[model samples]
Target chain A: MTATTTVLISDRPIDPDRLAADFRKQTAGSGAIAAFVGQTRAEAGAVKALALEHYAGFTEDAIAAIVDEAVSRWPLHAVSIAHRIGRMAPGDPIVFVAAAADHRRAAFEAVDFLMDYLKSEAPFWKQEVSDAGSRWIEPTDRDRQDIRRWRSAPHSGEQ
Target chain B: MTTRILFFGQLRETAGRAETAVDLPPSVATRSALIDWLAKDDPALHAALNQDSVRLCIDKKVVLAEATFSAPNEIAFLPPFSGG
Candidate 1:
């Protein structure tokens, strides 16, 4: 198989359709395609506004590693991820991840896996400013609980 | 020797700078040692580094809290990432 492309971007205001097109162009098989777009919400609870920050060089490298891990762990033809940085207003686009694979299962699983890893593994930080004042948002135990699910495989009864 | 230590998000805001040079004690050979040394110098970083919720990376690679560090390296302390 030829070498596929992996797009990892960190910028202000992410474009979901552009991310989808990137994945589509990278895959030749065109059997199945899956995409996930995560946008900023009006209410994240306790968060009046979120300011995301990352190390200039280190952020990109950390994200690239996550993308590489996704490519290795799954049979994906193409994968792309984009995230926004700086002071972001509510309801703005935050992140995008799209993958194309030979089957829907692979595509879906790959996207899910990438999202999980990105949430817990990537090196980005957000500070929530609100009526309570700006505080560095820390990942709650629930976030870890969600991450733990990926470590174990649930039987699908494929027999 | 000095190493470029980076801080992100709240840590940067608390420290009031994105990156700064921290003096390394002579026997500080690992990443873990560097954190210990830094905490001794900067109270804000000391508290942030000691928090279980925080993480560290060296030259863009996540390393264990006790990982070794070399001279002229890039180090960063950041809260957990939730990009997706």
Candidate 2:
């Protein structure tokens, strides 16, 4: 198949290798592949658990939009993204992203681009439960700037 | 025009539901205008909506502050994303 495919889900646990392999097969002719995995750290600071909330229908659509944008902006063969929802412990896997392309540059750049958009643009909210209290998490200015950098950064498909 | 407004994350929990219908004032024409009108109704929504961490999408596409939406549109307001 010459079409790009995507997998977006809000499951409890995500299979990292499987996700990577799926993208690999989809982009079989690709010479390079890139995958980024975000896992829960043991130290959530004062938080015990994090409750991830998302708009059921809108979440998938928004993520799909991001994938489509990446596919258009890069010569990507395939991509996969999966995010976890519900109450998660500190050590749980938070997110997974994999991209494949015919060249290392496109695969690497596309994966980074997708991650930047996903971080600031996706519709997932994190609520931290601590011994003292619980509250909603907000993105720091750092996160915003990280995403902003991508707008001006060079990419494989662009001059 | 009838539009659907969706809330996500803690905002949805705080608002007690995921989606709502926002009847814009006759003069309201853009997304920012709709936000301004809604904020006037609830101070919390006003504050929450103003935070930079919130993202706005019109008809399933992310939109800037000055974007406009017509009838039967779907607009979503969500908190900062933590997706990988």
Candidate 3:
């Protein structure tokens, strides 16, 4: 069967538990499932909210491309990505990615790979609103380094 | 022809607006030329856009500053991404 890929960008809150359950149902026959959820950090009351902005169609396309790359690189059954845009308060879910595969290794690696690319390459801009002030956030040097690891090592199933 | 220019993230803050339409002069044909033209009147915008980390996209596709086309419909200035 052809691998299924789902990508969604929501302005509303994302329920990570619901997303995981739905992915598990969709990829029922897959032997392993791996998932990751990112949440807005409270920063000890210093940060009040996070505002995320995306280039309507462009952001989704960028994420879909990353999903396609992940599917190609791994022996996967399905992949699902959900990201939240607009203003979000602390403790809110920011993003979720789940991958299903026949083995544990493929499932684990795909989620990791998807996140690294999303952090640095996706076209979403982020701003943090804090008690002191608001400031735009960009990918750190560590983020760049995280993504570089994939480029330096060739995956087994790479085209 | 009027080309729509979009600024995102810190560039949006620096530009003071999300988007603007500019009618290109004859000399402002290339992407680099367009940046120079836009930066001519605004020092803050020039400084923000000239940063090495900023990227240019033509019609939603990232392109080099030297890339040239006539009367493109849209051009966007994107700062580095910070998504999760």
Best by DockQ: 3
What is the per-residue lDDT of model 2 for residues B1-84, given as tens digits with 9 covering 90 to 100? Answer: 677888887778766778888766667767667778866778787777777657777777777777766663677886767654
State the displacement of the C-alpha of residue A118, model 1, in Å, after optimal TM-score superposition: 1.0
Q: Tens digits of per-residue lDDT for model 1 on A73-115?
A: 6677777777777777777777887877777887787778777
Highest TM-score model number: 3
Please give the lDDT score at residue A12 for candidate 1. Answer: 60
Tens digits of per-residue lDDT for model 2 on A1-159?
354666666656777778777776677787888899987654647768877877777778878878887887788778888888888888777888888877778888887887788777777788778888887776678788988877776464565
Measured by C-alpha RMSD in angstroms, how accurate is candidate 1?
3.0
- How does each model score on lDDT? 0.71, 0.75, 0.90
Error of model 1, residue A52, in angstroms: 1.1
Which residue pairs show backbone clashes in model 2? none
The true-versus-predicted C-alpha distance at residue A33 of model 2, in Å, is 1.6
Give the alpha carbon lDDT tens digit for every residue of B1-84 in model 1. Answer: 667888787777777888888776668776556667766777877777667767777777777876766665677787767655
Q: State how far residue A50 of model 3 sits from its true place (Å).
A: 0.5
TM-score attained by model 2: 0.77
Clashes of each: 5, 0, 0
Residue A36 C-alpha lDDT in model 3: 99
**Candidate 3 on A3-87: residue-level lDDT in tens?**
8999999999999999999999999999999999999999998999999999987888889889989988898999999999999
